[model samples]
Each structure stands twice: as structure tokens, then as C-alpha cells.
Target: MPVGEWDAVLVGGGVMSATLAVLLAEVRPDWRIAVLERLDDAGQESSAGWNNAGTGHAGLCEFNYTPQRPDGTVDPAGAVRVAEQFAASLVFWGRLVERGVLGPPEAFVRSVPHVGLGQGTDGVAYLRARFEALRGHPLFADLEFSDDPGVLASWLPLVLAGRTDGEPVAATRAAQGTDVDYGVLTRRLLAALRERGGEVRLRTEVTSLRRRDGRWELAVRDRASGGRRRLRARWVFVGAGGGTLPLLQSARVPEVRRYGGFPISGRFLRTERPELVAAHRAKAYGSAAPGAPPISVPHLDLRVVDGRESLLFGPFAAFSPRFLTRGRRSDLARSVRLGNLPVLLASARDNRSLIAHLVRQVTAPPSTRMAALRRFVPTARDEDWTLVAAGQRVQVLKETGGRGTLVGFGTEVVTSAGGSLAGLLGASPGASTAVAAMLDVLAACFPAQADEWRPRLAGLVPPPTPEEVARARRVLGLAPVRPAVAP
Candidate 1:
């Protein structure tokens, strides 16, 4: 083999890249690796805790993960997969904390109850079915559900405020859920990787990628020093969050053909009242109203940052020309490649519902948003909360049968058959399941090394199987069966 510049080059400094770098370093300690980040520091983008809901998306409180069919049947597959992935991440993060790689575990992750709240008879039925379907899953053994208003009140009293004195409601909760500060985790993991002699080049941007003699040649620019450089790597991973699409197009990999991104920006309402904040102790998620987009499903989350308990709600999705919140205005226009035109067209044709939802969102005034908020907290006063910009999520769009098709959720990993380059596309149930997602990337990109890497991964992720779920329940002291149906 002719001398390659490095063993691997990671394209971003977010959770995905940092996690991959750590995995590669642990397995191939002698290999040279470099991380190129466009920003001045790591974890400043969507992975930042403040930029996201930080729910640790376990399918625990998120009802959108388990949608009901037209025939009234519910599929628990999506919920189970998300729950299993989050379980694996907790085990992995725990091991890293034990190894001193992530110092002061509280800085990055904290345990908090996850609750799902809903109203009326129809909503109660959905919650009951969702609860039943998930209660038996090995990964969801700790779930609890109740229809009593008293039980619902205990979970979140404000949810029932100013309601008809006899109105009925329902709630389901799980103690195993968490709120993860992914940015903090990213910084800590990257610190350990650096300690192991791995190089992370901040403020370095990749201008282009080309295959030269079966190796990846990346043209890089040092953002701070105005210096240009070239790096040749045996493999390249593009973990650029929303920037991945553009980079993949530059590679002309063909696997990314007919793909386009639809940008959705989220906003939240936060309360500063200490008294109200103290009353709220868990993340309470609710079902989206009829015809509401899945991304617009409202939730009231209790967020603890820097040891302060603050309440956050909403994540109302709006249209944006920029792929990232900090991205350039040219993002949407520049990503339209010849190969992706069909995908773009197909997406618009298939997602009339999402388009209508976006229209209502954009044309609606601030008062409209306040009205939506009132559904979750009837007593919630507009004067008590302020609107805060959440983050930008670039949903994936692709061509299907000569038309563009829009997918609201699920993540796609696109890499050429050669496995020299790969990029992650889409969002949702993100950040919370970084470990499993990265593991899938490694499994796809490196098949031959998987058997050897499995043990190392298992040590970090505990048991990634049903059998381990039992052991985890015992060791973690979690309930074995939905915790006696909550009151």
C-alpha cells in the first residue's frame, strides 16, 4: 500500500464524528486520524443541548414514534427500535464515564422521568394502546400508564389547570428516560480522543473531495490562518449534520443521487418563573392534533441546564431557506444538483400534509402559537413565557417513481458501495441514539473488522440483546413490568 496521509478523516465535530473517532482510536490505536470542523469549536450546531429538545428520544414519551393505523392497529416496531438504541447508548455512556473519558457524568447526562399526556376519550384510547404495545417490550419494561385525572395531575398538574372540573385525561410515564446534553458529551469524548493523540483540526473546512488512486483526497482550508492543505485518507466519514448533502454531492458518489433536503426550523416557549419551574419535574409529551405534522407534536419538557430547572415547550416547525440555523442563505438553492432534481420534485408531490402544516405555521401569528400552547398548559400565561429559537432540522427528500417523496422521520446513511465515503442524512430520534447509529455506520463501512470489534463495543454498550435487557433491569433496578399501571 502506498503511504496514505491518514487512516481516517472525520468531517465534523458533532456527536457522530466524535463517537466514530473514539471507536476507531480504541480499535486501531496506531492509525493516524484527523477531525475537520468548520466551526471554531465542537458541538456548536444541532447537537448542542440548547439547540435541541434533549429528550434522549427513547420512544418513551414521544407518541409520534408509534402511529396508529387506519384500522386501529398499532405497530410497536419503531418504538422498540428507538428504545433499544437508547438503552444501548446509556450503557455506552456509562462505560465511558467509568473510564474517566467523560468526567462528571452529570455534566452531559441526567436521569429524568419521561411522561406522555393526552386528553379526551379518543386520546385516552390511543395512549392505552400505545402503552399496552410497548409495556411488554424488553427495552420498555419500566413503562407506567394511567387514565385517572389524579394520576395525570401527579405527572403534570398544569396540564389540567382551568379545565372542566370533571374532564377526563390520561398519562403514561417511564423513569428510565433521560435528558442528554449531547454537546457536553461531544466535548468530553473529543477531549479523551485528543488525549490519546488523535488530532482535531478546528476551524478547518473541506473544500472538495476526490478519489485519487483508490484513496480519498480532501482539499482543506484553515479558517483561522488562511492556509490551504490537502489530506489523503484511506477512508472518509462525513458527519456534517445538515452539511452532509453538499459534501456528498461534491464526491459525486452516485449513491446520493436524487436526494434533497427540506429545512424545518423549530421554536420553543420557555418559562422563567421559579415557582412554576419547581412544580414541573418531568418531560411531558402530547399527541399532535388532527392533521398536525409529526414534527409539530407538542411537548412540555423540564430541562436542567447548569443545574437550573427550567421548563421548555413547543418546537413548532417552520420553513427555512437555510439548512442549518447558522447556515448560509444559499444552502437550499446550492444543493439542487442534476441528480437530486427528481428527488426534490417527488418530495413536494408526496407531502401535501406537511406542506399544508408548514403554511398554517408560517401564516399564523404569535398569538396562534400561544393558543396552541394553551392546550398543554391552560393556566400558562403569555406574559410568563418567551419564544426562543430552537434549531434547524433538514429533513430528507428523495425521488421515487419519477416524483419527489417526503419522509418525516427515520435516518438514512448514504455511502458508495466501495465504503470509502459515507454521510448521515435526516433527523429525529437523533442525539439520543448516537451510539447505535454510529455502530450501524461502522458495521456497514467495515464488515471484516466487526467480529473483532463486537466485544469492545459490547463492553461499552452492555448487552445489545434481549437477554441483556433482563440483566439491565436487575442491575439498573428498573421495573420489570410497567410498574403496576401507575395509581
Candidate 2:
């Protein structure tokens, strides 16, 4: 066995790990850092472009962020926070582009229309209220609302082409929204890290984690050489996606207690027809159907990758014990830890909503899915779109409300005192907001150094200030927009 030491060791090659690596390399260049990926390449899991919806996730089109209250009012705080995170991400990507770390903007990111659609009077009222609430925000300045048939047709003719007009409905459209190729961005960030003297080891898996003499020791297996090695680091980050839980458990960390992940497999429908694809130039999202879970919201999007124009719809959730589609089925059972048992029990008790979701998805047939798709595109042909398997998402579960609670959305950061070892858990707005999430990791663990690191972090992503927000609001024509639901 060979032994080596580094300043830090990151145990995942997805966006979260890659983003952390970039930030660490930028702030602490002298510190030796190494990345160990179990696969042959990076970003092949959740960060893969094809594995998840490509929306920038500013909360503009996702209704789940603005849940309605019994009093008819809605909360805008969650949406605003999500929007700010996305803004931070945009600034980070902008800096990465200027530094020549990423490819051309068109290769990984491009401006696309984002529309929120709804039907019937209740949906219309909700859409109208949501539009009013967000119109004044800088990030949401491009939003436009309409209930007129012609206006709806102009934004998405496919959905309105031949539908009955008597049904009360409306939509909000934002032209500034974008589609991102997270996989490409991850690769580019990895490249940048390497260029700045960081080490990225592919085909290497961290088989074990242990602490010795106040330092974290990682046992790594080199697939190509069939050799085992040990590496020591001042700090260890478990960003291993579905593999994150088991690895953290091996460290005997208290935070991994009672924490369990519910794996949700997703599938998308893709189209090859250029004319049908070109006609649909925007990303259209809608509220989940009755009795459907929030994550099951249907969306029709225009996906452009490597100079190709195509359409995609539905991240219809499926059941799988495997964390990643490409991962082993034993991942779930192996990750159960004694500490997390309480958390798991609590999660299951609290997530009655998600239990209903699991039942609905597990029993749904293909025809039912197609019928759901027809709601978004009345003219969609069953033959035009084929079901494509996407990445698996491990929804975080823990103790909440004296029982097992399952969290369908939101990201969790698990860190101990002084942040010696940290791991990110949960789902929703995953890659779209990696910059802000990693920044949180830094602030929590390295508070003193952040003052010095702040300037560099700013260079990578300009922190959202009141002035920037006000200016962006004005520029996006949000000055006239008013909040229908008061905060």
C-alpha cells in the first residue's frame, strides 16, 4: 500500500464536489487537494446534463416554492432565497467564463424562455398572484403575465393550438431564464482546478474513512492498478451523491445519524422532430396535477446541447433502491446506520404526503403518463417522444414532528465543529445553485479566512447587494410589478 497526504480530499466528482474544489483551489492555492471519483469520469451522475431538468431554478417557474396558505396568501421568501442563490451561480459562471476555465457560453448555457402555465380559475388566480408577487424582483423582472388566448398562444402555441378557450387559464413568461449543461460546467471546473495545481484522480474510489491523530485518513482503491492507498487530509468532504451516506457513516460522524435517503428514479420524453422542436422555443412548466406531489410537476422544455435543438418533458418519478441509475442496488441497504435510525423513523412518520406520492408513481402505467403529458402539449404524439432514464435522486429523510419525515425538496449541509468533515445531503436546486451552497460550506467552516476569501469569492460571484437587485429590477421592467401576495 502506498501512502500520501494532501490538504483536502473531496470524495465525489459531481457538481457539489467540483464546485467546492474550484472554490478551495481559488482561495488556498498552496494547499494540496485531491479528488477521488469512483467512476471513469466526472459529472456522470446527478450532474449529468441529461439526468436532470436543465432549468436554472430561480424559483420563477416552480410553483412548489410558493405554496399557498389557507388564508389565500403565499410566501415569497423561499422563492426570493432560491432566486438569490441562482443569481450567485450566474455570477460565478460568468467569472469562470471570463477566466477561460469554461467553454463558450453557447456550449453549456444559453438564454431561453421560461413559462409557468396553469388552467381553470383557481390556477389562473394563483398564477396571477404569483406573477404579481415576483414582478418587482430583479431576477424576475422579465416575467410577463397573460390570460388572453392569443397571448397564451404567442408564448406556447403547442399547448394552446387547438385547446378549448372557454377554460379560465393564464401563464407567466420570463425570457431571461436559461438552460444549463451542468455536466459540461463540472468538467470545465475540474479542468480549471487541475490547471491551478489541484489533483483529480479518476477510476479511484474512497473505500474507507477513518480519523487518526486529529486528521482524516481516506483509504482509496485504484481500479486500474488494483492497488490500495491511504491519504491524510486536514479536512474531508463526502460529496459522493448516493454513495455519500455510507462513506460518512464509515467516519462514525454523529450527523450521519438517523439520516436516510429515499431514491427516486426519473424518466423524460425526448423528441427528434426539428419543426415541432423549433416551434417550442421556451421551457414551459405547470402545477402538479391533483393528488400529485410537488416534485412531479410537469414541464416541457427546449433542450440545446452540442448544437442540437430538441424537446424534453416529464421527470416522472419512479421507484428504485439504487441511488444512481448506474449505481449498485446494495447502496441503500448498506447505508443504514445506527445513528440515522431515529432520523429514518421520524422521516417515515412525517412524510405521509410522500408516501401517497410513492403509491401514485409506483402504480401509474405508461398510458397514464402519456395522458399527463397531453396536459402540457395537447398535440404531442406518443410516437414522437421516447422514455429516457435519468439520474436517481436520494431524498433526505430524518426525524421531524416526532416521527420519520421525508423531505422532498431543499438541500442539507451536515458539518461538525470547526468543519473538519462535511457532507451535503438532500435534493432540489442541486447544481443550479452549487456556488451559494459551497459558499455556505466555507462560511460555516472557515469563518476567519472568509474575510480574505470574500474578495476572491466576489470575483467569482458578485454577492447580491441591494443596489444590484434594485438596478436589475428596473432593467427587467419589474418597477411596475406589484406583489399580489404581501410578504
Candidate 3:
């Protein structure tokens, strides 16, 4: 029996679902909206502050976003697109703060410089090329670059400390970059949704989803009460992070027939030592090792969670058959279907280097992990940091040109059932791009409402102009932007 019907049902309590719920409420206030989460509380998974690096990924510090071309020039297109997307998120959040929908901006977001570090001769050259390529863009006009050790010392004292090697080094700094506590933001979005008459059901897991009579029927179970019920919705969105793949498979979505998932877990070295945290005031990203996945790019971040500061480093790969931290060990095996088996096998065959990289990371001892960290922080001590498990990211694998291809760090949104059903897959630059990604979902799934909703959506998340970006930064308590130094 169907207990309730809704205009939209979002299957997750993370940032993505919460964002979509809030957006829908703003656009179609008369439509009933509901969000279902399996966890006891919201934002406990990948959106959690501790589970991620907490960098507001605007393509500022992450070197992987800008790869070198054959001619030695850097590609700035990917980074520019990411910067624009993150600007939308900032604008939406700033509007919420201005309207009293969210509390103080400082509670969830803070200004933190983003720095891209490049070591060795080749690294230095690439860093300079990247800076030159991006400096002309409005979003990165304030970027600063330097190869002098003295200037670098002032910018990154902790990273420069105790470094005796004279190897060439370079860095680029963007002051507009920020560190965001997405978990706090997610919870706040959900809270605002409730205030707008949206329903949020926690501790309730959707067992399955089926299409019936122009609506999606979701079989839900109350984890605490052992009771089950059915609900109906005109549209259903699966934003369950790593758990999304299985749910889409269960729905028998044709778009997912040629898709598979490869689970990749990560561990970080975190420290709450006040001195160390204070010394490193920026999120610094370094290039990934040869033959490693882009997600393997090493980064050191200054994280502020719940008004407390700390430092995090080394997202060393960890192996787990489970798709999610709380998911079953059988998740990987259960997701392998006849339609996706070939894709999975091909992905594994083609990504042997990635598999080997994971193997090295999983079996590497403490000293090995420490050595990796020392590359970023020359004086880092093992005693000051402890290994902590990060979230599980399910990399999406799909058949492209008759061969399996592993999607990189970018997020992928899959829509099916004539745009009535949709799910989010992949990770990295995930939460930072929530607003833009959710907007795409709305456009893709609600084509009939596109023209009607265009005006309302525009008001909510307008195209980011230079003035709008400046205003959003000011509203978010960020400092004014500075002009870029001439190359």
C-alpha cells in the first residue's frame, strides 16, 4: 500500500539531495518534496567534514584539473569550468546567508588561501605555465606565483620548514579560495528545507524502486521499527554516494546497463596539533605519482570543522569490497550484473596500474605513508599525526567505443525512465559543485518545466558575473580579491 505521494523524493541526506530539495522548494513551493536517508543523521558519509579534504574545489589548488599539453602549454578550460561551477555554489550559499536561511557564514565556510605546489625542474616549469595560462581569466586574476624560496617561505612556512634540498620549486596562490565544511552546510540546507515544508525522513532506507502508472514506487523500511511501507513520487533522485549504483541497478534503468562501479577507499593522516594547523593556512595540492589516478594527487589542507582547526594530508588508497563505509562487504559482488560484467572485467584489465597503485597503498607500512607526507611537509612528524579512514568513493566505469573506461574525478549524473529517475555517480569536486550539478538534474529531468522554471531558477542561481562573484565573496566573509601579479 502506498502511504504517501510526493512531487519529488530524494534518496540521500548528503549535500546533493539537500541542495536539490532546497532548489525544488524554491522553484515549485506548492509541490510536496521529501528526502529519505538511511543514516540516523544527515551528512554522515562523504559530505562529512572528516570524511573529505574540505576544500571548496574551485580548481585553484588542485593541479590535476589543469594538465600539460604536448606543446608544454597548460589547459585551463577544465579549471575555468570548475571555478564557474563553484562560483554558483558560493552565490547560492551567500543568498541563503543574506536571507537568514542559514546561520553565520563563518560556521560553515571560511577564507583559506589555495596553493598549488610544484617541485623539481619539470614541476616548476609546469606551475609557471599554468599560472600564466590562468592569470588572465577573471576568476583567477588574483593568482600569484613565485619560484623564489624566500617568497615561498612567507606563503608556506610549514611546507618550507626543514627543507635542505636545493631542488627547484614553484607555487601559485589564490586568495579567493575557501575551505568549506560541507556537512554543516548540508544539515543547514536540510533544516531550511524543513522550514519550507519539505519532509525529511531519517533512519529510513529505500529497499527498491519500481515504475508504476507514471510514478515511481519506492519500498522503504524503517531501520529502527522493522516496519516497511511504500511511497510514490512523480520523480526520484538517487544521490546516495557510493550506494547509488546498486539502487539504480535494482530499478533496472537501461542507462545503467552498460555501467559498473569500482570501489576505492581512502585514508588520511590528520592532526589536531594547534601549532601545525596554524602554520599551514592554505590547502596545498601536489601532482600525483606516475601511473597513478588523478584522485591520487596528494594534498595538505587546513580544515576548520565546528569552529575548530586541524590539518589533513595523504589520501592514501585503502582497499575495501564494500561500496560505502557502512555498506555490506557483498556490495561489490552484488552490483556485478550480466549486462555490466563485460564492462567491469574490461575496466579491471585496462586499469592494472590503478589496481597496482591501490595494492601498494593498502600494503604500505606507516613509514611509507609518512614518507609521502614528508614530500609536502618536510618536518612532519609521525607522532603529530594519526591515520584516519576517509570515505569510500565508487568510481564509475562505462563502455566507451566498445571498451571499458574509468571516469576520473568528475561527478556523473545519470538520468533514465524518460527523465523521471536520476542518480549521481563518481566523486571529487563533488560537493563543491552541488548547486550546478543539481541545476543540471532539474533541467534534464524536467524538460516540460524548463521554460516555466527558467526565470525562477535564474533568480536562485544566476550566471556568475565578476560583480556577482565579488558580492558573494563579501557576503561569505571572504576578503576582497587582489589583482594578479604580472608574469
TM-score of each: 0.94, 0.93, 0.98
Q: List candidate 2 stretches off by more than 4 Å.
A: 1-3, 465-487
Cα distance off (Å), candidate 2, residue 181: 0.4
Tell me how far the alpha carbon of residue 174 in candidate 1 is from the true structure, in angstroms, after superposition. 0.9
Candidate 3 lDDT over 240-352, as tens digits, reads 99989999998999999889998888899999998998889999999999989998899999989887888989799998989888989999999999999999999888889
Off by over 4 Å in 3: 1-3
Instruction: Evaluate all candidate structures by whole-model CA lDDT and list the values in order.
Output: 0.81, 0.80, 0.91
Question: Which window of ten consecutive residues has the lowest lDDT sum in model 2?
Answer: 478-487
Total clashes, candidate 3? Answer: 0
- Candidates 1 and 3 compared by TM-score, better number: 3
> What global local distance difference test value does model 1 have?
0.81
308 Cα displacement, candidate 1 (Å)? 2.5
Ranking by TM-score: 3, 1, 2
Number of the top lDDT candidate: 3
Evaluated with TM-score, which candidate comes out highest?
3
